[model samples]
Target chain A: MTDPRLAYVQRKTRRRLAFSAVHLVLYFSFSLNWSSWGEPLSHRLGVTQVTGSLLMFILLVLIFIGMEFLFLQMESKETQE
Target chain B: MKAMFLFLLRSAPLLVLSGVAAAAGSIDGEVEQQPLNTTAIVMFLLFVVMTLLITWRAAKTTTSSAAFYNAGGKITGLQNGAAIAGDFMSAASFLGITGLIFVGGFDGMILSLGAFAAWPLLMFMFAKRVRNLGSFTFVDVVSQRLARGQIRIVASIGTIAVVIMYLIAQMVGAGKLIQLLFGLPYEVAVITVSALVLAYVAFGGMLATTWVQIIKATLLLTGVTLIAILILARTGFSFNELLSLAVEKHPKGEAILSPGVVFKDPVQIATIQVSMLFGTLGLPHILMRLFTVPDMRQAQLSAFYASLFMGYFYLVLLVLGFGTVAFIYGNPEYFDADGKLTGGINMAAIHIASAMGGDILTGFMSAVSFATILAVVAGLTVSGAAAISHDLYAQVIKQGEPDPKTELRITRIAVFVIGLVAVVLGIAFENENVAFIAVMPMVTAASVTFPILLLSMFWSGLTTRGATYGAIAGFLSSLLLIVLGPQVWVSVIGNEQPLFPYDYPGLFTMPFAFAVIWLVSVTDRSARGEIDRANYHSLLVRSEFGEKAAGEGAVG
Candidate 1:
């Protein structure tokens, strides 16, 4: 029989991988076709041209940082259980 | 292709730094040797003295193999995370990328994001399992559930191969910087850097190395923060205004705001992104830092902190890059007689530093650059030494249990050998095509190290024979593709056409490696293969629960 801890940790690992996969997909979509991706976003947002491209890049990086925190938070939840 | 290929970095500066080695006197055009900046000398000397004193203290407790390899796993996640950032952010890379943005504008932000993609990848895939399973080097983790001796032999070959190339490029780059900064002769600079690296790893080990990294990271972060803040203040704290002013001054004008103005190619992007992604997974210095943490959670925290710091750092570079353009681009005082920026484009961040706070801040940044070289090279040397001592010697030659004192002695000896090798190679290859040397470490990491590491942890069917064959295949194929590819074949060998068309082979080679390992493993019906498959259960339990998992599994 599988240990409950193994089951719990595996679920956590799956979630981490799933989240990271989503992040990679976001990154790769832009990276692979950045010309098109940046074209629409390159339009000026408000007072500046800090448009879709820069905003999207910033969001991706934040998600990069946020994914780890999200994982750690999930980890804390497990310990409580 | 060259522009895209430049994005593959364990540390971003090493790639541009290779060119800086050659760009010293010839390309910068009539730029005379920089005078010995007294402030820089004083700052560097103070840093060296403090680090050496730390090394002396570290030497006292570095009596066992664990202390030597990983500081007895005593580093907290926050501290280890800062060290990882220091190791990742070479002063050269930080300045180099910022300078890139200073010249090219928005594209540099893309490259920063590209380099940063590694952090999430590492946190999800490598950090947790590697910390739980790996003891000293990556080889320890890779060899855990397999045939230990044979698997280590394979993994160690990859580690040592990658380390040697990475170490040599760093040594050569450090030498060039020292010569440029201190106005010293080239050979003297190489030897001096080598001597310091020997003192750090051979004597003080990881404790001294970690502290040096932490200190350097703190100084670099502070310098970048101060410079970013000072530059933003000039534009009334409005990032949009800064970009607008940059558009006005830049030669390319509004085109600088577009993505493809400098470079945009889909395949090239995929290739660099692939290498940076997988290469981070397989980089020995980073993988080595994983074991320095006490547990898996701390390991996760370390990667997270590194990501947070790097994210903040990259955002600053984006602003500072545009800010430098707005302020310094057309400013005649900062440019040379030919109307080029003095000391080429890589000096963009330095010029901004001078503008921000005059010679004092510039000198501090310069000293931090030199300190960065030391910390990076020291980490590489330790990883290389551990590959020789812990993986090859103890795990392979001594059958996995060498005497502690004996292993420690072997590690120090290996350190000396690598130091000597780096010194000789640094001086010998000073004028050679450094780009060729720069990409080799990534080829091995992306193809061999990352593939095997991923498969070993995730696959249940892997056998020793399959792993060995798979690793050797991946390493050779990647190396061959690189030699036949654009960077080496066309750029270095003067060929009209590259046999392999891409700048990097990882986009093809990584998938090929996974296929080879899978194909070989599934076909292996040997009894040992069965045992290898069965061992994955306990390996999984141990990896998930760490050392607290007793015997076969954890009993919560």
Candidate 2:
């Protein structure tokens, strides 16, 4: 069996890597929305450029806040335990 | 082949001379003089006098290192937010983005949004943890678990590199702004601004720096808001009317409302946004501001308020940029005899200001932009000084046992030296339009320091060697890539081809730095590595619940 210390370290590293990946994906997704890649989303739906851009901006902020809130909840749970 | 060889031989001397010119840093060309605007001079002096008075007051209150570096952690959330806005809204954002919009049209809106998008990530990811962990510098957080001496040296080097690069860019921009507004010689303008920044940082420290930023932010916000309101008023508060007018007046017509007007490549777009996002994350001066707030909650509030102010200002920039096209497009008065922008394209927003409110309001806006440059340079200088004295001398060299008076004295001396160096470099680069030079240091920070900072905060496997190597990789790669990039190769060096085509290098280098740190740290089996691994749980707890992890009976 693997040492408990090594197993713990592996678990923590995976957690950190996962969280960082999510962070990267959010930023990248925001970039896609701002780029020509997301042009079809607005064009096909008949959304005006301004409304589409504003919606993207609002969605980005909400997602960021949600992620933070989720982490804070985990921290609080850890403290209670 | 013979004819081509003959042509090459004939043009060899001219090519050689151009290369020589590039080496001499003479590519930017000299600023042409216009009649001095006395209104601008008077308004600028008025601002100088007020900030000097605030510095004198701050000098009295700055009695200890804590007060000088982080203002004793007493600044209110709202005030800190304004100061943060002042710090980030920089000459590049105020003048450069407006200039881009003036010239590039719809492409300018993307640039403005790039500036606004970074703060959400900072507020959500790093601000509270940064505030909770460090007292003065971001390096403080890294030194908490890692070996202090080596980590401090690496972190300090990164901080100083970012500051110097940023300071040089701001100084040159400041000189050009003064030259346009007051018709002062570039050297004289650079020297004057540099000396004033030195005096501000040397006398008042962070307290003075914070207040200067606040005042500058308020002035800028008011100035830009008025310009936007005036632009809107001219259109009867109608966005559709403004858009139609701008499109009708612009040379490109409806194409000015489209994205491919400037940026055509998707990779380039993604690279620019990625650099900006990561760049803000690792900027030493911006992170230093977090430590000046009272607690994590205040720190979060600081980022939130800054985002609001910045978002509103960027919207204003968009309108003003398009508005300039509406009013001043093809207008001979705003252009020189060569059909070039009279004060260069960076003065697009200023021309809009003049058109909106005439000489009086133009002078106010000019003074506000000048104040913006000064406040930014002062912040950079103070932080550079701290890197040298606090990080290098007191912490690294002296092992945290330097004489307080001597260290403060060294910090003051460093400030003066940094200011002088900036002035000299500013004069040499007076002709270059490196307003995008601000982007360079941000990319560097994101590539080099942000990885180190993020990994140190979150990763248990982060050893001293891992952190050091990771940062070195990031630093060297960013510098090498930027030197070979189009900005330096084609624009500055007047080369035909760039070794690295992309202007921003963060997308590739930031991830590479993170990978290097991970690979090295996971293999590290030293005693220190094991201890650091064990320390991660506590760090996370502290990062999350503030003082509760330390058994301090739960923090507010």
Candidate 3:
């Protein structure tokens, strides 16, 4: 009654967890640097407090997109393997 | 894993600082004063028309029960994702959170952030399971390994509880928003929203609701983004300056950033967070969206997209809330004759928009708000209807095959019935505290349905007896607790003091439900090896990657 499918699923699960772990590290490191970069841009952009907040928002979104892209790439490699 | 920990660690400090900032606000100064404008009227009409058009278009294609209940299973991952975003981004997110943040500061954003954070967990936990189940109701997913009759009874309770709670919250919010923005009578607003949502669901079914949600989500995101940009433009792009402005206007300047300054009660903050985060993952209406997508991968992808969309929208709300705080404090016009913030806290979004964007933008924003209400109600109605027509009536009662025609008729009728029930409930409970009521039902649903659903998918030992008993136990305990819980007793029943410290039952009830299911399953020897291995495999793996696999099978 050994199910090959179960083993396959277990392997997939492990790989996904590994991928997720890598993603978490990248996002955390990137987010820390974001505020420092955003502060200088806020001054240079001469936007109001709210506008500066909005720009920060835009930056966060960009970073999220990059992370998602990285995730997709990782997923693709796993699928190929 | 490391990345997630890092993300959490980085966010921890900001969250703490923000908590401190929120506590300094006095309830009196936190309210806004603003005049209602003509723009709100135009926006209302626009949403009404948009809803009608979408419903009419949906009616043409929704010729069968499947179409009505599950959009005939035709919706793409992207479309469904947008719709999911639309459904989740209710008037509460657009208006309530913004207003709460505007008044309460960082504490409000914490609620928003916590709710948004639940999306990824949902993706990981439920997305594949639900999509694989391929059933129209949460009952279908939970009942796959259990007896049909038992699943129906337990699931119906969970479904009704969540829908009723959610409907009441939306109706209350709609009534207040209508009165504030359009001078409509509260009763009239409630009836109008109920009727519009009913019509949208009845005629178009899931197709109409899905499109409406997609459109609404797009508009809401766009509107918030635009408003955020406008606010930033006014502030000269300085996050610190915006904080300074907010600080200067307050008596307890800079203290607004500190936690406990606004809410003062740590328990209340914790309660709000738990209810928002767990309640989100458990919501039947939200989880039902997974079934509408084409496959498991799409289901997962849609969730990811929804998280991104919701995360972005919440960030804008944070800015909008702070913008309102900074702008509205000095304005005498925002106050009523008694000098109380003229409208309830929820009106801050409209008031801020009116002030910043003038009449046209205000009108546009109001329309979007109206659309938000409409979109959310439509999603709720469709889910409710599916529970009745697809789960209870067709599957459990008739045991009929879900032929295209039967499903369509049943769905439309169910939509009408569910809509009627909501309207009646809304009318009767018009005076109740809508937010509190809404959160309670979601907790009940989450406590009951969430465990049953997860166990049915992953736990092979789960038997019909176990699932049935567990779901019932979870459903009753959560409902009873909520009804007798201090929040309900004091707030709804007008008791002087609450019996329980925590408002949410999830911290207790959710775990209890899972424990009951496990215990019951383990005790029943007959339950072992009950899982239909072939069926489960087909349901989960084949449905996800079967197209290519099917081709190979044919060659063999």
After superposing candidate 2, which stretches have Cα over 4 Å from the reference? A1-27, A30-36, A41-81, B1-32, B431-439, B548-556
Q: What TM-score does candidate 1 get on C-alpha atoms?
A: 0.93
lDDT of 2 by residue, A1-81 (tens): 245644544454455456556866765665554466766433312322243543454455556546645654554465477
* Pairs with steric clashes in candidate 2: B28-B431
Top candidate on TM-score is 1
When candidate 1 is compared with the true two-chain complex, its DockQ is 0.65
RMSD per model, one decimal = 4.4, 7.1, 8.0
TM-score of each: 0.93, 0.86, 0.83
Q: Candidate 2 on B80-101: residue-level lDDT in tens?
A: 9899899888755776666666
Query: Tens digit of lDDT per residue, candidate 3, span B1-556?
Result: 2232233233332222222111100011121223455677777777678778988998998777767777877788788879988887766566666665655555455555555655665665567667765467677766554566666777876787777667766666666566666766768877888788887888888888898889888888888888888888887976667777876764445444433334455445544555555667777788888878776667778877887888788877877878887887667766555444556555668778878887777778877776777788888888887777777777777764556576667777777877777677777876654434655655666677777776666665666667777777877777777667654777578888767655566667777878888887778766332543223443445433432323111111
lDDT of 1 at B246: 88
Worst 10 residues of 3 chain B by lDDT: B20-29
The full ranking of all candidates by lDDT, starting with the best, is: 1, 2, 3
Q: Which candidate is the best by DockQ?
A: 1
Task: Output the better candidate (1/2) by TM-score.
Answer: 1
Q: Categorize the docking of model 3.
A: incorrect
Residues A1-81, candidate 3, lDDT per residue (tens digit)?
377766666665555556545533433332221234423432324433333333444454455555554655655576688
